[model samples]
Target: MAMIHDSIVKEDVVEHKLGFYPRIPADSIFTRENVTARTKLRAHLNTPLHLATMENKPNSIALLLSMGCRLSYNNLDMSAIDYAIYYKFPEAALAMVTHEQRAKEVMALRSDRHPCVTLALIAYMPRVFEAVQDKCITKANCKKDSKSFYIKYSFDALCPQLKMEDGNNVRRKSENVPKSQNIPLPALNIKYSFKFYQRSKLEVDALRLALNDPKYRPEPLCVINAMVAHGRVELLAHPLSQKYLQMKWHSYGKYFHLANLLFYCIFLIFVTVYTYLLMGSSENYSHTKKAAKCNLSDPMTFDRENKTEKNNVFNSDFESKVAMYTSTVAILAYNAICLIREAYNVKQQKWHYLVDPSNLVSWLLYISSTLMVIPTICNYFEEIQFSAASITVFLSWFELLLLLQRFDQVGIYVVMFLEILQTLIKVLMVFSILIIAFGMAFYILLSKVGPDETGHHLSFNSIPMSLMRTFAMMLGELDFVGTYVQPYYKSETDILLPFPMPTFFILGIFMVLMPILLMNLLIGLAVGDIESVRRNAQLKRLAMQVVLHTELERKLPAILLEKVDKDELIEYPNNKKCKLGFLDLILRKWFCNPFTDDAGLDLVLESSEDYITAELEKQKRKLRDISLVLEQQHTLVRLIVQKMEIKTEADDVDEGVSPGDTRVVPRWSSPRIRKKLRTASSFNK
Candidate 1:
């Protein structure tokens, strides 16, 4: 019966038509011969149908009626079958009967001897009724209200035009036919069936079956859906891209550092060369002075003979020409050195060379070189004596002016104390020269008086004669001075003083030793200058150290705070755990300590808890220290402000008073305040 029903469904779908069959007894058994007969009948009718057993006895009549099937029995309680046939298969009903008559017909059919006849009738009849009822139900539910019913066939008959080696088709044919024969028969064409089952498993299995079956296979909807869901993809480099960005930054940073190193090296070389040249020239000058002294020419005789031989030695024209050429060379060298140094400074971005020792020395040499050119060339013009005294004074003035200019540029208050030391040295040098000159002049003037009542022996006859003899003694022409005047003044009758005339002359000679006095003064000046420079340098170094220490102190707390915030350090992962104790770790890592020991590590371990607490306390201490430093800085700033105010007030007071008028002294003691301020500043440094 199942085979017959399946065959009926296939056949009915192919023909696109409906079929109906009579109901059967509930206890009836189905057979193969019945199935074959039903299959043949479906083939003959060219229609598809299905069979189903009704579960509810009362609804069986109603279900059959809704399905539109005919009654095939009488005297078999046929009222149910009649009602089912008339109601469900009104168009499919070939006959109808009452219940008693239907029951009698069913009993007679049961006694009749037709092979598989009952089974065939039962299988095919229900299927035909079901197919008709389904069509009617679908029509009733369809909003379009379709007028005709059609059957969807199986693969066999539906695709007749789709010729394949294994002949199979799954489509339907047209159910509508023309009312008149003149309409002409429409040509039948094969069309594929696209059916959807309401059952989920049926739809899935249908897709799987279609994919597996070679002959009826079609591309499944799932394949296209999957392709759209996951398509072309790509991989990108995140870490490598970041590394490339960092590499660019490092390259630029390295280039900048290299450029800085290059400039620094160039500056170092220039300073070295400049210092060498200046020192070399100074050494040469010292050697020249020594050579001049060793030559031992008589200055007095040289002066006298030089005046006599002046015209013979050099014509005025030649002298003037030599002076002119020397002056030009000196001017050119001076300007060239100045321009070159300026250019170098501009290139190096160092506008202030005064702060640099090498640069200062080089500049001093250049000044000396310019000054020496005039003196050296003056000899070529004999009339100009090349007065060292006048040149010294000029050079002193020049140096003073340069120092003032430098002080102005650097700031007056900053360099004023340094200038004071320099000025003191100059004053001492000048005073020493004057004292030596006065002593020599005084000795010469006092030598004229013979032994007086006071027991003073003055052997010279006249002051001018004594002066010439004094000069002669000074020049080491002692015999000429003594022989020329001593006999007349030093006869045995002449009273003799306690000290001999020659002893006084020897004492005058000591006073006339300019080099010794000059050397001592220079030594003193050099020592003072060095001390001042050292003090300034020490102050600057201390200031820098203070700043560096302060920065380290400031940065340490931040680093410690950062470490504290990363609480993972308290219970670090085993792989990352340090073997050392906290103090040892901090000393080694943070303080960059080189040494480690078991004892020290034990100490660190013992103090770990205290160390953490101490670190927090240290952080607070650092904060307090910073606040104190800030307060000190603020106090210093206030002091500077007060100092400035005092200075301004002093200047105002001075401005109101006339230069010749007696000025009133301010009650405030600025010098004492300044000393205290300086002491404070030194402490800070």
Candidate 2:
């Protein structure tokens, strides 16, 4: 049998000038008509042929081609033969070519030069099959029969295993075919059926495995449900929700009411306690008794005569009681005001407000509260008294100072102002005490000396009489009488003395001078405290400002450029900008500026190496210092341990040995030992 070999010759002609050329097969037929009509007729005929020629039979190409169909052929030398075929027969022309047939064609024509062609043919097969199965070729209206014949011939001939064994078998097989070929091809259908079941089984198994696998299970859904349940349980169990189930509780409103009630209670309690304490003091009793005797309504009516008489009558009398009562009232009033204000603030939800309640208004309230003590003082000291006025003034001043101190504790400025105010008040009180002491001393002097000896002293027997003299001296009014006194008779008072003798004498000798000295000391102390507080505040403010300025500087470049411009940020001079105040040299040393100007850069560069060297030197110094400190500490520890050891050894020796007994040492000085002693002594020496 003669073998009929069907070969594809693909030519990529630039133009479709359908003319017989030298490269064309002499017997080959050519046409310019569309390939659709031929493709259909061939498909109708070849479909049955393909079914009939089952069981991997050969001559499938020839059998189909013999039935008035043609295959695609171009000059065979073109590298893009497979691509050209695919491009020309993009429709059902490729439909008849199976994957196996396409694979075989690709292998047979494989070449480095035609790699794209092999890839194109491989890629085209599946697409062509899908299009054919979807019946999309009919939409193109090409020569379907010719296209189909070309596809079948190329597929079977290119597939070496499918080719006929003998050329004679091709004709015999076509001729022997029954004319009544109406039976459906079961084998052709069976091939697709097997593929369909295989794909379906794979899909089912994948679905089964996905459902069974823990990794694929819907854990998020389970967690979401659990969270929902937990949230519901929490909401149901919450006390706030239960308490305000019907009516929601506004915390602000509740707090306000409670705070107001607390404030009122505290205010009432303070007032009641203060009144009780004031009434119990001795000054209140004297004032009440004195007011009754004189039929007086106020304590202020008690004159100096009545005060002196009362002081002479009862040494522990009205002044002391008044001081105690005033102080107690002042303290209570101050605290009450603070508590009330705090409570009000808590109610108003303005807890951060730093307002002081014991300010001007509170001071007025404190002064008014002391009005209740008036009647008692007037009734007790109606007639005879001395100037107990200083005591009352001092008490009031002391009370104000104490209140100021409390205010200072609450706020710094208040503390500072109070401290200064206290210093001034104390100075005044000290001067007043000196005046009083001098007046008492004058009274003693005047009473002990007769009026004739003192040269007509006017009523100097009384404390008040002496107080007048003391005041005249304190006010510089005594200079008129100084000319009459022997000490001032020879003096020329034109030049002021550096240290006035009288002032120094009074300041030095008097016990009252002690308070003045203490007051001066307090002034110094207050000044020092203020300086410290001011420095701390300044440092804190400076630090905050530095941070603020740095942040602003960082953002300034961006703002100026209208974009994030890092390069234009402001730099520091000498790399010395620090978060702390300008005085902190250590922090300045550590801080560096990347955005330095030319001058700054020059300075930085000039000093950088030197600075590093200096830093190293500093570190070395620090290390040495640390080493010294460590050595000292080690020595101290060793000494302590030695002492401990000595003590322990002493204790052990005493415990182990008999009391009052001495242990003997070997003599080594005996005659037998004489030689040993000489050797031992020589070694010791």
Question: Which one wins on TM-score?
Answer: 2
Q: Give me the runs in candidate 2 sitting further than 4 Å from their true place.
A: 1-417, 421-436, 445-685
In terms of lDDT, model 2 sits at 0.37
How many steric overlaps does candidate 1 have? 35
List residue ranges in candidate 1 displaced over 4 A: 1-333, 336-446, 449-533, 539-685
Q: Give candidates' CA RMSD values in order.
A: 49.2, 42.1
Please give, for residues 456-539, the per-residue lDDT of candidate 2 as tens digits: 345345788878766666544454344234323433442222223553465345433433454466568678767865655423
- State the displacement of the C-alpha of residue 597, model 1, in Å, after optimal TM-score superposition: 31
1-685, model 1: which lDDT tens digit per residue?
5665665444333223221333432222134455566565534332121121111132233334345434332333222233333345422321211122232232112212221111222233434322222221111122222332211211111010111222364321111111111111011111111121011223334445545553332222221122122320100011111121122212232233334344434433333333333334445456646755754667776566546655564574365445445444644465475668556665644554456543564455455444544543443322122233234334434434333321112223334445555666676556655445544554444444444532222434444455544444444444534443564366554433334565557555555563356446656776776666555542332222222222222323333322221100010011122355464354346433222223222322225687698799899979987998999899998899898864444444535655557777674557887798889999999
TM-score of each: 0.19, 0.20
What's the distance in Å from true for residue 671, model 1? 66
